[model samples]
Target: TVESRAIGPNMTACHHSYGRPDLLVYCCPPGFEKSVPFVDFELPEPPSPVKVRRPAHLLDESFIVKYNKALSIMKSLPYDDPRSFARQAELHCQFCTGAYEQLNYSDTPVNIHRTWLFFPWHRMMIYFHERILGSLIGDDSFALPFWAWDIPESMPMPDYYVDENSAFFHTERDFSHFPPRVADLDYTTDQNHPHRSNDEQIDVNLKFMYTQMVSGARKTELFMGCTYRANDGYCDTTGTVEHAPHNTLHTWLGSSLNPGREDMGKFYSAAKDPIFYAHHSNIDRLWEAWRKINNRRLDITDPDWLDSFFFFYDENLKLVKIKVRDVLDITKLGYSFEEVDHPWLNHRP
Candidate 1:
């Protein structure tokens, strides 16, 4: 099993070893300086009626109002509270940008990205985020809406996120890539790349999605990412989807002028934007959708993969340690994605 430590009072500055030394990375909040105790995670009974996460484009005005209200309330909480929005965003920084080190290997950083840990870790992160959002609104059945960028009609940035007056809005994003602008699934940070019309871009995106989700992801390791075990220095291989649309979408939404694309462009500051949850909700849904593509499509059976763990502060502000095995099934977690037609499923490149 990959032994890990709960992020407590000992977090270090986030350093992107591969990036410019002068670049400043976001750090955990002052709240993390106070040692917090964590409890072993216990599986809760499935919700009475499974919470159905819908696409961002299809959300009604009422759903948008409720979501905006919940986020506003979460942001209003004291910074010391683990359930507060600032703390939650810092949690992503702690895990992804070398803020926490391995349990016994002080020199080795524990990074959840660019490895098999990517999916489950993010899944658990958003799971608790959704619960906290729902709890703030007094609605246990509320679910996070997904930005289904793979779909042609819903290709652009969702409308609700771009509303400047809404709580979901974040300032540090590329204004040129707003709604009605079809997202390039194979987006590149190179400014010189040629542009395509909406029809052409949609066709290209659908083909790209098919390649990433189908032809490119046939094996468990290929779909999930490279294995990362206890004391491993760093595993840099990422799954196809994680490499493209996932990372691409981040850079696409992030402000081009920022040092490292603040908010969505980089790991340390990604969750600072409220739309981060919606983006990840779609990534989580893709994991579920990928498994159903073939009878042989299954999760990694390695004991190390199943037994590795991470820590998170739940909706009630109680720190909990949860294993990867515990989050393999979304249904058991009391939420599911609403069924939708995947046009990209048939658009082979």
Candidate 2:
């Protein structure tokens, strides 16, 4: 059976079709970096302008009603609602199609900048989507949560995520104990057939980011994973963990996908999937936690970093573009979350 399991909210690896046993194992690009041992990132809390109440996980039964309402509208949608899923899909189609056409297809090695921008842009996109969910659930305090991947053992899998009956619970699948390489791989250009194995490789890149450790280019590979060693379509087969890299549904979407397998931190092709918001929310939560661990990591403080963007839709199904600057002030959007009591902050290893 195929394991089309989800990673974290809205994102799942669809690796069953390639004759691979699981999507969990991906091939390494050239110059594969050592895997960083998964470590629990903990830190003192950072003060926020907004009152940080309990986390979103502790929301009550009523929240589920709103969650389902918003989610249903996002996917299947309501019969009377003007802003339905069909409208959203239609708008995206016109926008993406028009955008793709304006570019020069005649150029060799034509890459889509839109594809590159999709992940971060979608981050904000889903942020709003979840907000609608929160509003519908009647708890402005809600935020879509994520699946914590850095923990060492028994990380959750898809089988346990969705249960129409249950009120709230997480799945099971530990990243730390994930399968390692089954046999020695011949690090050659001809190495093609891909499979996965489990090992005890320690990741040096994560150590650098979470801890104040130092790592060089090898650290890059460590940050990404095995996909670094495998030959990317690009000849620059330098091995290192990459971020915002691969598009899981690029073939299905027939669009250009990013090349990454690093921390799943930055951008990912999986965001197009409806659950992208939840996976990223977990990622964003970790970012919040990391900021507390180390002050420097706080929300995009870079001057020229282009950290913000916008997303909206029009009546005629045209994709509306928003800038990062406008939405940065989340408070002005007229929403606040009621603190969660038992957030999955991963206090226990």
Candidate 3:
């Protein structure tokens, strides 16, 4: 099926398969000579996420009068024009305090892939924080849902903050303590992961999920790599392995990036923090469940990582500057996310 419209809703696609984008090629372990397996295809079946809890209140003035009547048909360009909305909130204040002073100054690690401006700067910081939460309830159709971190049951306690009773939360104090072994390198390596009293000790890489193949034309390996070699720690990246991708999770940061975690590239105040739009609506639902896993074969052609770029922090908090060509066009900057009737649990990593 694979229908259309995303983030705000109406996205039909019971399933479909995909292929070719340089047919999938990766090599870093001991400098390979050859390895191209995509094997033909078959890899969709890992979507079971929907756990957003923390609304309490705000948005009810009839949701800001039905979103100022959809912002009077949505349009706010000339605030003085630097490409206005007030010079894109003045380069979103050097992209959220210059990405928290270049990712808290460790040793240069920011790589949302060498840059076309990290996907239209987080799709114009999730379309100006979903149009300032749809201009505070006036309603431009309101859509915000990511937090599925690929599911370790939807992780929740990495030191949890944003008080005043869940004040529009959005974390990433640049959290740490991962590396039990994504091939281990040392962000202090071994913080002793018994997982602070076994929430299944990191829930086996969020339940497990990975299927990739194309075969003959070249190479492929993770016919379903489920992390932990053959399954022992079980699964746990839902709250930390720093959000997603390992066992060979290479977006290559989209393609060669690491100016030392440049504050993990903006989104700083996380759209006035309502848990940063439900943790980037579950990081845009794990980038649309990792492009409908395997069968959708993680598409993404890399013309310099398809011109990446990033900058965000909008809603009175300002900081805009986005591009990946305006998020490959998240439906011409509007809204469309649903999945919330509940019971999203077939489970996989």
* Each model's lDDT: 0.84, 0.31, 0.32
From the highest lDDT down, the ranking of the candidates is 1, 3, 2
lDDT of 2 by residue, 1-349 (tens): 5322111110111111111123223221112133222222111123323322223334355645555556664555552332454433332332222211111221112111232223334445555455455555455555565433333221222222345343222122113321331111111113483332323212221232233111222232232222110112212222221221122212212112222222121122233333334444543443334334444332343322232232343222233444434344435533233332222232221
What value does the lDDT take at residue 102 in candidate 2?
16
Residue-level lDDT tens digits of model 3 in 1-349: 5321111100111111111222221111121123222121111123423222222122234533443334323325444322223333333333322211122222222222112233234445555655555544454446544544343434432222223233322243333322221211111223573334334433443333321112210111122111211112223222222223321122211112322222222222123323333444544544443344344454444443343333344454443434344455343443444443222234333
Q: Give the TM-score of candidate 1.
A: 0.93
RMSD of each: 2.8, 15.2, 22.3
Model 1: runs farther than 4 Å from truth? 1-21, 29-35
Itemize residue pairs with steric clashes in candidate 1. Answer: none
- Candidate 2 at residue 120, lDDT? 35
Quality of model 2 by C-alpha lDDT? 0.31
Candidate 1 per-residue lDDT, tens place, 45-137, comes to 754568899999999999999999999999999988888899899888878777766655666777888889899999999999998999999
- What TM-score, over all chains together, does every model reach? 0.93, 0.43, 0.24
